[model samples]
Target chain A: MLRPWMRCSKNWRAMWNNFKSKFLGTNFKRFMGFVKKEFYHIFRDKRSMFILFGMPIAQILLFGFAITNEIKNVNIGILDKSKDSETIHITNRISSSPYFKIKNIVSSEQQIEAIFKKGQVKAVLVFEKDFGKNLKSTNLANVQIISDATDPNTANTVTNYIQSILQDYQREINLGIPGREPIEVRSRMFYNPELKGVFNFLPGVMTVILMLVSAMMTSISIAREKEQGTMEVLLVSPLKPLQVIIGKVFPYIFLSIINAIVILLLGFVVFGMPVQGSYFLLALETVLFILCALSLGILISIISKTQQTAMMISLMGLMLPIILLSGFIFPVSSMPWPLQAISNIIPAKWYNLILKGVMIKGVGLRFLWKETLILLGMTVFFIVLSIKKYKIRLE
Target chain B: MQALRDITFEVKPGELFGLIGPDGAGKTTLFRILTTLLFADEGTASVAGMDVVGDYRDIRKAVGYMPGRFSLYQDLSVEENLDFFATIFGTTVEENYDLIKDIYIQIEPFKKRRVVALSGGMKQKLALSCALIHKPKVLFLDEPTTGVDPVSRREFWDMLKRLNSTGITVLVSTPYMDEAELCNRIALIQEGELLVVDSPENIVANHTDSLYKVAAKNTYMLIKDLKDFKGNKSVYAFGEFIHYTHSNSDFSEERLGEYLEAKGHEDIKIVKARAGIEDVFMALSEKKGTEV
Candidate 1:
């Protein structure tokens, strides 16, 4: 027989006691101490600080400005055997485009191989004889384009640019002619109208910088403690292993956030890379990716016995895959089937997809839920595996 | 690989115990287990009356460990490192200042300097202070004086004696035989096996053979010559002198001196000497090797 108010007060008291015990059980004060020590380690070392903050900005700027996939100012050798008005007009049109510069003109086919071998010209274009006559009489003409196939990507892109320039010239010539209706395929580039390489590379740089700073830095820091023998001392203390790991990871999380902001600002200010979506959503997704990378770092630290090993594994095991297989430099659809399947497991792949979706496509969570879910799953998997591996090493 | 096997020893409360062994004698492995950093596959260990496996959390709060290497944060200042460790242990430097006052005061002048800039002796003192800041019940130090200078080594032992006087149990491991005399009890281990465990005096008293120190002009050749002596049971070089124990209990130093003279050795000096812990350690290791 208790009053209702009294019953509610008793329940509240019990709840408060449970909450207090749980808070005391984890020893938050000790965890804060570990986190503070980690900050001291980060701030005291000049070299590590440079690697943490400077490297990210440098990498982002380098990728945005210097490194590119687009072909421009390529040197080509033209062997115009026809010497007709149409052939001359087409040659002039090709040279006018900024994508190519006619470096050499050969008199014979034999000179084509010699010029290509000299490395002065990457492509050779030979016009068939009577090119203008054939176009007027049979409404067709033959032209050959031979490019260095050693670098297949560059070769393909160069050939495509030349074909598009020739097609445009054909439309201009046939515009006033009557009784010949040529079918023209109108193609337009969306989102990036000029096909600026920086636009495509911005999201990739963001993913790589975040992944490297978060995963690689955290792993190296933890492995350093083990190498110096301080990890043993930490284990002997009353701090739980989970607390130690969280404390080590917390500082990197803050650093990685700052790095993300720096990269976004540089991309916007220097390259004019647009952030079409909500900044808040982009930030939330970036944080999710950073957590995934941090957990991956923890897993690497647990398996490594020394800082050098941890660094090597983080670079070779994680960075290379993120660069090659995460669709950062190459399109995933064009990759080999096996590589495509393997890319699915790389967390950066999902993060890159989400970045493009949110930042470039201006899509909300509804469009990016799948990628977000994948990143969340990877974070959970890495954290769980790290904990299990840590326990096994302790035993 | 099985790093340890059939290892068994005990340390009483308020007693200073020593694990005397060389580099690969599994001393570090044993210390790791006792500190709850590692698990033994086939046996059990406990620290501060708590099981190392089941009650590791309780044991962790009651023990402090300093590994063989200098393990403090090299980038952080000495004071920062000390403060971090103390704070993590739910205590402060002021709370445990009395426990580490002697060692801490030595390095207080350079407290603002980074640990990497400190001399070996100062680093040792800083590590000791950090380990003691928590006021742990049992302190496990694995070869803390291995790379330290001799002067620092002696000072470290004095510090340990003072800490032990406060009723805190200390377990320390070292490879130096001379350090064995400082411990109340020592376990001589080799190749992951404990050959003998006893007080230094008792271990020396248990030696049955009459030991002699023999030195000549050519010490190396003298050792080669002494190995062939018919009365020799064990012969080893000890600094400037070769410590020789005879199979025959009645063997005399004069007889050994005469034998060396017969071997074309000049300026020979032979004297009866007392057995030391080093001698006992060598004899026990040899006996254990034969038994194996």
Candidate 2:
């Protein structure tokens, strides 16, 4: 009985030897040179070097800290028009709850808007005059909770917290008064109910990693050829334009797939994310995603005159939209109609949806067909544009 | 051979054909078209009898192009860059080992070094090896020696001569006039047009104006005063001397020297000399609207 770690190390060594034998053939010397060259490029560019390694860590930390579903210690402002015992009791209950922290108690309505503008308060709770007297006679009271909806998600969370606090008070009142009929309401959240950010983020990370590695990296590489004057050499060679593009993009595609695998492994082992659908289908989708990204890279390369311009275009034009409109962190369904319409044009939105459906829901082609078709269409469109642009440059 | 606007000249097999021109003289544009990297909107061009556009793929297979800049894969090692170019032609360094053996041997010790880490000369040799890896029939080197040091330029030219001896047609472009003399045939082009195409000696012999090299202690004043001489056709500074060629037969070198001396000039030395290719090029190219 061999030790597990030792056995695994020996197997890894064997696989490594096999891989070397296959690619390196009799020339281990040349293969080492190639790998050294790849390392040189990875290390020479400080920005890309950071993005290659540091970005994932930063994203994880940011998602873990800033973008959270669980709301706690949210700053709330209360306005009590009546200084009665019932009003004070409700105010104490609201403030003492772990979820809400009252930043101020305002006596005037004008102070509510000023406190909100100063960013000291996230939500303002208001109680009307003679609220205890009204509750005693009519057995009903109305209170208003106003939240700053600049960041709609946080605003929504604050409002929900206020509503829950109010309900707790109502429950206490109901217990005191017997024979009171309580209409029961049950709530169920759709899609991701528990709001595990990783569950929502892993697929988004996959899209971004694939796009950055495939599109931005490939475009920069191609534009680099033009900048260095090697493009002319390749163009003048007997190799066709298609052959040249294929050669440039092929290496990146392989590298991006490897990157994708690294991310997926991290997602699985570290985050405990399970792949519900067929691994083969997921791999197929990854390949399709790579093709779409590569075509976009080709298109970017065609439009750019230098590596810098290509990189800027890929960053500002492509990556931003993918991150913002793809419904990776934010739900596209809850966005304004104009924004929803705009999200439809983004390829990452569909890919994110497809990944969620396949990995989380175990849905197959029936659910993913539209996304696949959209990706394919985008690929074709980009390929055609790049080809046309390439021809024009030649002429 | 089909002409670029009635200029018909063919580079003999294994000949070093040079295009000497200034910037914007269309040297790169012409090179691009001939190398199959671009298509000329009009007129016909071919490499080794294969049309540039129709037979582009074959031409690409048959030609080795080294553009103005050192354009090997910089991020890759010298050896990996070499291997990649070799692989592109469906061959390995071992298969065509003899073709780049000389250049490859020079950079062999640095095989493990990344191309971006290599010196300018090393980069040049690597590019040349990558270009010749496919054993091309026609080699188009576009200003390959432009920014390189003098020694490197000489070394590069020597390598080209060596490659040409193997029966590969070499078409080299350069802005340096001295390099034009090294070519078996030279084309002088300016302003997107070919001015003259001929052997260096023949072009020099075709100088239609009389030439004189006049120098004085006050060389600056001599040039300034000589330009104002009534019978002088052209008077321009060449090196430390003023070269004044007369169009009027009545104008004498003695009279010009006398005029310079009267202006308080010293060490006046006037001599009749043979015109170089550059002089002939200047004379011909200066003629506005002169067609090649």
Candidate 3:
């Protein structure tokens, strides 16, 4: 026992020492050390390296080209038996519509199958004999549109485009003619007038990449420590649970941001995608979405005991749902009602809505506050859940 | 249902304490509990005058633990791994270089090499260095020499001795009974219960029996015949001989020799033998097993 004043001074010294040790940015520096080790892990491991850098580019290219769903510059063959002015007029009309390029004129019907089998042409237009004479006297003419049915969707889209072009020609020819009426249905698709799938895929691919790079990579890396038994060592150290979680998650935030930027840049430059809303809002929302995914990743890591289990859960659990329920590939509205309701709980679905609002729809926070709040709420929920789920010891 | 039962022991400051047990003798379980990495069901444990559960944060700061498995990052270079652990513990390697210099220097030549490329001995040295980087007051090592070569195991024990002399309380567990002799005191644990706790010399000294090394040509049959001996108290087979202890203190070797001779044994060599830590361990374990 000592005098009160002397005891108070000793306590003061102890407090200062504690403060200097615990605070004063030592934790920050230690957190940085953890992050530095994480970079070593990501850089030295080829699987993480590839997913961190290569997958974004590959996915962008894949979605940009493979599933474009646009009908542009499609080569087509025309078999004209009539050799009349009307037939020539229709052929020129089809060629100039920007949907079809007349590759070659087939003289006989047999050549149509030959070109299609050779994969030279996607479709062929065949006209019957005396086509102009029949249209003038009988008020009717038949033209058969034969398309390559290997890819049924592309074939259907091509057929629709050609049919629309033919209808446009008929409307132009029948305008103001006596006793002859051809109904015209003019439909306009807003925001994307050319009906480019790239516009849709920009957000879709962005959603998928952010979810994967943030969630899957983080979970796998964390599970990797558990498998390697370094997690036991980490727990035994002076590092707090918060420090470990943030240390394990912060690098991925940085990397996922890089991935976000890469996806946005590719979508903007390569595919001519637009960022119609505020760039600040876009970046903020991107980070929020990334945080949501990172927290989900932490939750996944908490549940998994091994890297293989984490990978399987990420791929089978996260990827398919993010790709499917997020409306990245298929429209959520078209899905069955139960699935549509289930999509509401998916963070990707909400992030997809926000991304489309800001990037494609050119709407600000005023218009997208609901989706943004939903995403923010989901992020908070996941963070809270993961914090609850995290283990403080090696149980 | 339980990993450790009624296990109790204390290590004085600066003592090299050893937990001697077989593979599944709850050595790792006890270590984990003391390190604050695990919880006990029925009892409480403390480390460095702090409760393991309530003051776990403080205990974590004061102790350095090396798990049974190799737990360092395999993909990281040796220097990088050391730096990483030092940093996470809120200290730099240069700040605590003197603490681990003895062990770190042995593997420093391979500092830039990945841990996966290092040999088992070098890895153990590096692991010890990493554990010591923070200069913890107490060190818990679980099976540090389980897979190491004989020469490296000897060198590792020497390092542990040096570290212990530096005023760090070392609590190490090993399945090798011979290594227990190197410790200042050893606890023989088996099946979640502690059998005995004493210095290695005292444990062997307490084994008061006129032990004899009896070997014959038919060694395999010797095990059965020796077990069938009515006067035998304990019979454990060592590498070249079967160590035997008789119930009677001053049993005559000539009478045993005559009995074996009548049993058609040749090249029979019966001579006195001294008990080691291993023999004591086997005898204690067997006694415990039979009692249970």
Candidate 4:
């Protein structure tokens, strides 16, 4: 009793359903298989696993505790030629500040040279014979600060700290005098009021660790297949080139996410660094950066024929630029014009900006949309280039 | 540099085909093209009745390739490697267990061991098992026994023969001429060109010259003396004797004996020898060189 059209439509629906299941079911299974295999490869190699999980924590601790730019407790030799009450008071004031630790009270200039030569003190502060008399008679006291210029950065910082301490002491002495209070520049440091170097470096460290782990790991892995001749087998399989790339990179994405989390936790617990913004926004930015880095890795792998070449390229080409130009250590505003322009193209620079904006500035998507878009664009560009290069090379 | 040039041959379904060549003979290049890993710049290639370039997806599903090197994940265990390949092919190990069971059983006890720890033969066996996991209609093995021992090489060939019995066409390439005899059909290649394509027996039968094996007190000196002999076309040492071919069609044993005697060779033995695939290969190579 059924019409002919009804039977035809029923057959058509059955064919469509069969095709959908066959296509999607097989692809999903194959992709899952690839991802599982990748995980096995990662987990079985203890060395790589250690690098993946342990390195971020170690680096965070190392950067937080050992490597610092702030000066604290610098040993300084004081040459007090006058044993007057004023000189004693100045000496006490200098020693009382946390920035300077007076190692010796030298009686002569020769003693100052000897202490500096022994490398016990970084700088020598010499007060003149009539220090109080000069300040009372002429409203000027001459104090000589001779610092060892061997390490210019430390020497400069030590000298600046002593000068600030002396200025503070002078203000205290002039508190009772009329019209003699120096112009006090009460500069309040914003964002990081404590001036902790850890606050400045943690974001840079996050950027660098994510870049190294995600980019270097992926590039070396893909190039290793080429070196071992396994890429040929994979290419000959039913997996497309893009699928092969995604399969290889899928596990790394998860690892990088874990790495980012570990870095954030270490920064919070060990360094007491703040995450002022929403954790969701921070995570989204981190994933964006990781994708950008991974795409760059794919591009490098497509160009390199061997694992060694890939590794070298990643280190020298990617790591160096990220460290030097991404405002990680050196301020981008201070770099030369050409280098600054070049840094604009470096993906890490934008990522570091986004990280700082979200983590330190507590900004939302409205403030970070530009940097996020740039990173996303770079990721697309790198992926397209890599796919084009891969096709050309394979052909 | 051009790795392959003017290469032309055909392999029938279910035939055990071999590509016999020396090092740098472009055997790997040909296999790469046939497996859809590379494209031919000038000519066309098809596998399983599909164009290599256009129908690569279908070809990939229809073919299984074992590259010239051990290409498995060295960090993964034997079981993991096998399971990975099976899963990627959209099939389970149990579904095609019969195809690879013969080879996989040999390495089953060490299934937990990483591939890097496996011996050379075990590695090749594992690689072969991975390739056959999908039960494709065609299998391409490039230099599977290059570094394998003699005993393992024999066993690997036996495995291939057993697989071929189940109607899977196999294309194997090797530098060893002796392996050519095991193939139903072989193509001898040199310097990226096809030298000959035929059954091993037919190629050996087609050897043109009358060959001789001569040995004396010092085989090295015998080779020198035979090279200086007037009728010598080619003289090379083969294991315990020197295999020599003559310029003239009518080769006389008495002439060679007297020639060796004149050169003060003692304990001289001379006999007619049958040409093998090696001899045919050498002759064809020399012919191509002279023509070029």
In lDDT terms, which candidate is top? 3
Instruction: Indicate which candidate wins on DockQ.
Output: 3
Evaluate residue B238 in candidate 4 and report its C-alpha lDDT on the 0 to 100 scale: 81
Give the per-residue Cα lDDT of candidate 3 at B52: 97
- Model 2 residue runs over 4 Å out of place are A1-46, A73-156, A165-178, A197-202, A259-280, A329-340, A392-395, B1-5, B95-109, B206-209, B248-252, B287-292
The candidates, ranked best first by TM-score, are 3, 4, 1, 2
Point out the higher-scoring one by TM-score: 1 or 3.
3
RMSD of each: 5.3, 6.2, 5.8, 5.3
For candidate 2, lDDT tens digit of each residue in A1-395? 89998887879988788888897544453333334444556567787666666776566556655766778898989898977988899889988888888899998999989998999989999998898988777767878998999889889988987887778777777775766536645577655556667788889988887888789987997788788877776676545567567766766677777777777777787766778888888888889889999999999998897999999999998899899889986789999999999999887888888888888888888889989999889989999888877852353
lDDT of 1 at B256: 77
Worst 10-residue lDDT window, candidate 1 chain B: B247-256
* lDDT, model 2: 0.80
lDDT of 1: 0.89
lDDT of 4: 0.89
lDDT tens digits by residue: candidate 4, B2-98 = 9898988999999999999999999998998888777788989999899998988898888989998789988888998988888888898999999
State the lDDT of candidate 1 residue by residue for B1-292, as single tens digits. Answer: 7777788888899999999988899999999888877878878887888999999888888988898888889988999999999988999899999999999999999999988899999999999999999998999999999989999999999999999999999999999999999999999888888888888888889887778888899998999999999967899999999998888777777777888888899999888899998898888888887887
User: What tens digits encode model 2's per-residue C-alpha lDDT throughout B1-292?
Assistant: 2223434457778888999988767788788888877667687877899998888878877888888877787767788788777766656789888878877898999999988799888888888898888788888888888888999989888888888788888999999888988888999987776788888888887776888999888777787888888877777888986777887789777898788788888889999888887777777776654443
Clashes of 3: 0
Q: lDDT for every model?
A: 0.89, 0.80, 0.90, 0.89
Docking category for candidate 2?
Answer: acceptable
Q: Give one digit per residue, the lDDT tens place, for model 3 in B211-284.
A: 88999999988878888877888887898999988988657899888888888888999999898888888788
